[model samples]
Target: MTMDGALARIIRSAADRAAAAEPEVCDLCAAPVAEEHPHLYDTGAAEVRCVCRPCSVLFAEDGAGEGRHLLVPRRRLRLPPVDTAVLGVPVGLVFFVPRSDGTVTAQGPSPAGAMRWEVDASAWQRLTATFPQLASMAPEVEALLVNTARGPRAHWIVPIDDCFRMVALVRREWRGLSGGGRVWPAVERFFAELTERP
Candidate 1:
């Protein structure tokens, strides 16, 4: 083949490779999964895993692998506004993760990611007591996602992955210093879509 033809062939091959989507495999079982798949929160690793149905079902009710892996729930809840002064989260968007020790960690999304913030243990307990729904959240795998970025603040009991998605959104949209104006609307849209999800 001529030199020009060889270059064209190489370029075409590269394009073909780029167009081929990589198969998403289950982290637990290594099975190929669909675009939208169940995810599990590996407590042992403190990370999330994209998994197939069967592998996720193993921890559906939680407490599988000696409580090492917990299935992330799909439950979504829109909670009424409540007093959160106790938690003292500095940011407008926060996600609270429950611990096995009966304490909840107050965290907020930033350009960095989901960041843990300090809260009074007694006050957190009181807040949870005031809201039984908060107390009942599935430990480790679910989070109370609170959004106060815009007026008429909203609160939702969201999946842990949803919280991570919000973290990712903020990380992606954030600009230098004051987190550019675009970030808030994007944050709003994120919650709006979550609200619309069935």
Candidate 2:
């Protein structure tokens, strides 16, 4: 099959698997959740929690809970023109999550786990200059996800939890040295879904 056809098939298969899985519950309230739900980033714990609507709203403000819990925004922005090489990630895919300390953590998914590295401040400044949206990403709750595998490089400002979800997907599906035969297409599908999201 062609690459696009194969990616569509893989996405369908993944969705089928999701449909067959048991429902999830709110991490804080224990309320049942749909297959898709809002998330909250626990800044203190550096983790994302699946939360019910009420709990999600409670932390919607950036300062809510004294910077403890920040609601992950649903906004997904297509980044303006930029060069991926400046980011300096060895992998073609990487995500940048802002830290409270005025720095960003650059990470990518790999067979081993989420591999992280320090981002060069000058390079980051260049990117933010080109795409000002990067500077406004909700601290500790959103991230910039970049995919540079092929074609025109794409970047998306997405929720921090989404980045972690991508990392988990990679860790779960990766095989062999070059991510085996199936992992790349799965990653493609992951980004495809993000692009198609409203």
Q: What is the lDDT of residue 153 in candidate 1?
A: 89
Q: What is the C-alpha lDDT of each candidate?
A: 0.81, 0.81
Tell me the deviation in Å of residue 46 in model 1: 1.9
Ten-residue region with minimum lDDT total, candidate 1: 189-198
| Residues 1-198, model 2: lDDT tens digits | 999999999999889879998577899999988777898877777788899887778886656778777788888888764576787777778888877777878888888878899888778878888878888887777888988875456789898888988989999888888888788788888887875243
Candidate 1: stretches off by over 4 Å: 1-19, 196-198
> What is the alpha-carbon lDDT of model 2 when measured against the actual structure?
0.81
Q: What are the TM-scores, per candidate, against the unseen true structure? A: 0.84, 0.82
Number of the top TM-score candidate: 1
Candidate 2 clashing pairs? none
